[model samples]
Target: MNRPPSNILGKGWLYCTVFLTGAAVMVIELLGTRLIAPFYGASLYVWTSLISVTLIALALGYYWGGVWADRARSGLSLIIAIAGLLTIIIPWLTGPVLLATDPLGLRLGSFVSTLILFSPSLIMLGMVGPFAVKLSTATLAKVGASTGSIYAVSTVGSVIGTLFLGFYLFPVVGSREIFIGLGIALLLLAIIVAYIEHRHLKSAATTIPTALLVVIGIGLYPQIANSNRAESNESFQTRFERESLYGWVRVIDKPKENIRLLTVDASTIGAASISHGENLLAYQKIVTLLPALAPEMKRALLIGQGAGHMAMTLKDYGIVTDTLEIDPAVAEASIKFFGFVPTGKTIIGDARYEIRQLKGPYDLIILDVFTGGSEPTHLLTVEALAQLRDLLTNQGILALNFVSFLDNGQNATLASVAKTLAQVFPHQQVFIADPDTDFNDFIFLATNHAMNLNDESFPDSHRTWLKQRLVNIDQSQGMTLTDNLSALERLQIRKSEHYRRMIIDLVGTNHFIR
Candidate 1:
């Protein structure tokens, strides 16, 4: 027996419902990353909190949906009601999550707070799929098709939501308003669907309650999110850029004074502009340290590429240099802020991937990609190192960064990183890049040539400068990130609840790691 045409439309509507629900759930979840990132940072813990919260809510939604679906008796009414409820409550819920990120420190744990603040909304959003599908298919024969249809639709919605939010909404209003506005949009969609399915004016009566909630939600948006680049004058020109939940980036230049600054979130890194002869800003001190280990700079690769300080040094020596920067914005900034005019090739991709793609016979490869106490673990892994080493010249040099201690004390991650590099570099030399701040600074110089800190390896020129900056002290303990170790090497430290906790403490609570 053939089913009536009404069944097909029912299936289509059900699919649409499932997909839109999924789309909404994902959009908010992705958006959530930005909310807590400003407070706690975009670190592993933030990821931990984000993933855990989403999964837990999803599980609850699935269980509750299964039980609640049967009680509805009328699939269409339940679907409309759920869709409507999503729209109204989300806007009302957006403000509280943002407000809860205060006392920004590890102690406050923005990740945990955000989880609690946003979970209910997410849990409700999560309930859309199973609930939508269950109602559309009461029998086993239709269940698979119904479920798949819903999933597919939701995925499509996810694509639309992600693109819309990432490119258009978040950039203009930032995550704060994006969260509330998206919530309003989702709520309105639900109300519209409810009105369509239930023509009774009473069925559409959710408008008043939803409207009241959205009014308050709109009031909660934070005023300052993304204007740093636009507002700051050309004097503080931005050279490089990267946009992530972590923060917006700007490599500011003050050429007349000879200084460049790399600002991300609220923190910054900078040095003197060579064009202005203002004296190298604090960052270029790395080059002063590196040459002590190996004098050769025939051809090199520099990671991080900020305002092209290291590259500038290399170019001055007539050394050809290639740069690996993950953000296109940084390259664009290079032109505007640093007057860095990139010569030769610059790859806008992860260092790990770019290194593997290299057809190089490089004499030196310097790593400068650090934002506070973190860098991509993969970029430091054995495989990444091996691929990088393959690109090195016969007597080439490899300079890796390891934070010693800053403002506070010894950084365990940096100590560990030093230890790991020691395992690979063996006789490698470690140097201080930014000397003015005595907290601690390091450059892991790996070379086959025998070099010592006292003589040619630690040149008199750089050493004298380091002494002047007051950063000559040594750090006894730190984290190990070496080429010889397996990728799983950091697993114990990475898995430790304490390690993450310690970082929360070291980087400051409000300073999130993503």
Candidate 2:
């Protein structure tokens, strides 16, 4: 094995370059999810595409990098620098690419978007490992040591990048800014390595103009992102937007109606009209009426407190409600923008884990957890329903809110959930909040004992609505959603597509501008 001239950059500098490039690769991978989440949702398919593309790109880069390292020893720094520059450019290009691909629908569009924006940069970053190994090995005897040292350093960098970006940097800075900063840092490192190796003034001269151009581009990003937002409908103004651990949370305001809506990713989770003090969403109002259906209603467990609309309604009805929300930012935004006062005890954690820890024989338990228009399928499995059944009182009702088509043959998610509930509870009743529509809210009410729909405790209007919208599901045609064989996410692909289109229609575009 022929080694390059001993005058090449110091081993320390080479190791540092490998570490930084490794960190950048992971950062870009994580940010890619955030980039496409607002449009396609961070679904299983979306994640699978992103991860698979990244690994494939890295594999290709390793092969190409090793070949290049042997053929052209001096070009390693240039390769790393080029990769860094490309990574920087990706964030800027993402908005346009998403807009252009909006017509492709979710599955195909998400795959294409990740492939276009993430693959090239990742492939380049992957080259750092083999390139570093080649440059650091001084002799045949030291090759093993050199390779292990470089890989260990690179892995450490990946761990730091993952933890820091996820826990700190992502929450404090905008995703666009983070990408720009990472790019600038990587570019500077590349320039430094080139100057160290060759003592070339021309490398510095070339880097100055490129750095300035990157800065200028960073300055223009806000305007470009804003222009992208101009494609959305101007009817509603976005009052607040934040990327949380759960997903993208936005509080949109309809000034004319005095309505403030809380949307997670592209799906509207909760809404409240300032003019009406109570809940304005029809589904929310329906859930609140659960106490009326049950004989006793003292304590209630409300899972997934999006904007706290249902929790507030339950509290107003004299039920001591305990709310559980996975994302703390959501609960904070709910109180700040959506008039959610923290009257009840709010627990911040995953509902599945928290539900198991809680000791409950409550009158009502409402499951309304949805992120990016899809429910966490794990929470809808047969085992989950059985756990929920154990928490309910003997005559207590378990109410679930699901969005699906209710036209008999078109409602797989709804029917599957109903069938699963029947397996645990003796009686299950389905109510379509808007029976006339093709796609609407389908509320499922389940209980161990038969529910008395004729209970005069319910308001006459609610009773009338329930009678009109009740769906008689034939269990023979539906499949139970189990932990091992849950198809809720797959079955709801059409609804997810519809959600994308509906958002595009509502906002006049499917992409997230901010």
Candidate 3:
């Protein structure tokens, strides 16, 4: 069994190792979501998989660490060194692991991919806490205090790491860079611990080469990943890519099809034609037609400024529009690539919070929010609908863009949304963008008064299509989602899974998964 450190400096170094390892654990857990988001999406299932895998890995590590601490002569250096190596190799392992697990479907695929990619490093990091507790304990009497102090320090590290990554690092740093930097830090930490313990550079002979490998990996891996991304695929070409807190924001252009798409995670937010810079999405067209529903529509509020298509569309009709978009990266991409100029005041925040902040009596309030293959449950609740209702004028129209099946077989989530909306605006009319399929972009136009459309200005095709696909939603078909209780995430798992698969099928997986 190992003896406790003899000096204060030695003990301090040991505790530092514990702190860094604790931080690394939380960082890896959060970064795992970003890594998988491009391919599998940051869906509810993906989060569940990563979270569940992290807990399991930690549990196993805790048990193994306690046993090892009692039996082994060294402290946490070797475990940390091994973990660092595994962490460094994650970017390399990610592509292969995702490819192999792709056939497992979203839930199982994401769970298995996370297990394969993160479990080993997490298990090693988990060993740090128990080992630190063991190494710091001096006597049987003081063991309790030592354990408590060490754990408290570790928890503090975790808290700091969570805040740092979420608030700062996520927007600026790439996932691979963050992973490599973390791995290198851990490696250097292992060396420090070894030097403190042995009082010579000789003890770190094994770890020195491993650290060098991590350095080389950091340099070479990016080139390899970039080369793969730059592969000559005739189907599509990636024009822009940025990893943000919201999702993996990408602008993919299909020259053959003459389309440019703005995709976040697994969902395409907007698409524009290459030759003409016009928005090519059916939902955007339907939304543009919304102003015709209210001829005196002077002011509008657009939630989810996706590529700023609908916002720009409203601006074209001489309406003063305010936009609420969460991701700054998305806003940047929309303007730089899609030629979207913000016509009015643009607020960069979540819809729920920003909606509360707005002092609006808007004639048109559009709800076109979607993230990670599903609508945010918090924004779709009855309480959220009430907020939107309060913001609208008496004759104002609230047009919601939703993706779900119109048929009874797979329409539970859709029905729930319809039910929630009806609670606030009872007079609602639903229209399908594509009548050929059950799963289509369903636009719900809600108003306090009876719905009437002035088709005089609209083209013959637009007028005919609008009249043909008008659908009546059965509001009592599902449960009401509210702030107190929400099963929207649970109810949307299957729908999200289907949506993910459809995206993969439409655009080949290499652009995302690789």
Give the per-residue lDDT of model 3 (tens digit) for 101-183: 99998789999999999999999999988888877777889888888988888888999899999889977888877887787
> Lowest-lDDT window of 10 residues in candidate 1?
220-229
Which residue pairs collide in model 2, if any? 233-507
Worst 10 residues of 3 by lDDT: 1-10
Candidate 2: which stretches are off by over 4 Å? Answer: 1-10, 140-145, 200-234, 455-460
User: What is the per-residue lDDT of model 1 for residues 13-49, given as tens digits with 9 covering 90 to 100?
Assistant: 6566666667667676776666555444455656677
Clashes of each: 38, 1, 0
Question: Given candidate 2, what's the lDDT at residue 123?
Answer: 88
For TM-score, candidate 1 versus 2, the one ahead is 2
TM-score of 2: 0.90
RMSD of every prediction: 6.4, 3.2, 2.9
- Name model 1 segments beyond 4 Å from true: 1-9, 64-104, 138-181, 200-247, 251-260, 266-283, 289-296, 406-412, 433-438, 453-459, 463-514
* Alpha-carbon deviation at 429 in model 3, angstroms: 0.6
Rank the models by TM-score, top first: 3, 2, 1
lDDT for model 2, please: 0.77
